[model samples]
Target: MIIIAAVDDRNGMMFNHRRQSQDKVLREKILSLTAGKLLWMDHYSAKQFDGCTAPQLNIDDRFMWEAAPGEYCFVEDTSVAHFEKWAEQIILFKWNRKYPGDFCFDIDVQKPEWKLSHTEDFAGSSHEKITMEVYDHA
Candidate 1:
């Protein structure tokens, strides 16, 4: 399966996007990956498409509901054992821990809080539109 994942500053691995391909070979890869899959990921990978009706999660590995909480383990491609090795690596590396405090080299480390916004909030240049509307009304 052509699964593209990234390890974050927290060492946490998030598998979110599946690349687009119509070739029979590519489709087979996807099917094999999700056939016995036990985890689902979000749409972080959608950014690659610049914006398209990309598949969020393959057939069986659908997304989790907003009101519900779910957790999944990430497996590396080179590993022999699937999810088991990935989960073990995460625990040993403390993937869930906070960002490291110090950096010996010239590296920038910033711990920022995540801001959740409605999809509509990104519909347009909202700030500019609001200002123009207010001026017109005035």
Candidate 2:
């Protein structure tokens, strides 16, 4: 039930300390949907998220979630459904500590990495393919 959001960098997604775009409707909807669940976020969103009773998960100590060697991670299925239904215009990304980069987390619930599909739709759906780049956070 946590409506997790990350800061979008032109290069990739990050969560150490980045501000969220101002969108009253999106904020309200996020608050409503995440009623009382834990809302994990980076340090940048603390002040903006004021009045939000839900707990904000800050991952400052850990830059990202590292997937096991040869393993991957992503958002949940229901979360994707919520995204497609509510925030279709938005793209989602999960923390990948291992690779240290943003990836297109596919919306396949069957895949264990299926948490939230990194929803990065290009200008056109005909784009051949997209690849993720891993950075050295260490």
Q: Could you say which candidate leads in TM-score? A: 2
Candidate 2 — which residues are off by over 4 angstroms?
1-3, 6-20, 51-112, 115-138
lDDT of 2 by residue, 47-108 (tens): 55666655523324221232222211123211233233222222233222232333323233
lDDT of 1 by residue, 38-78 (tens): 33444432222233333433222223222112233222212
Off by over 4 Å in 1: 1-28, 46-138
- For model 1, what is the C-alpha lDDT against the true structure? 0.24
TM-score of each: 0.20, 0.33
Alpha-carbon lDDT, every model? 0.24, 0.32
lDDT, candidate 2, equals 0.32
Model 1 residue 85 lDDT?
18
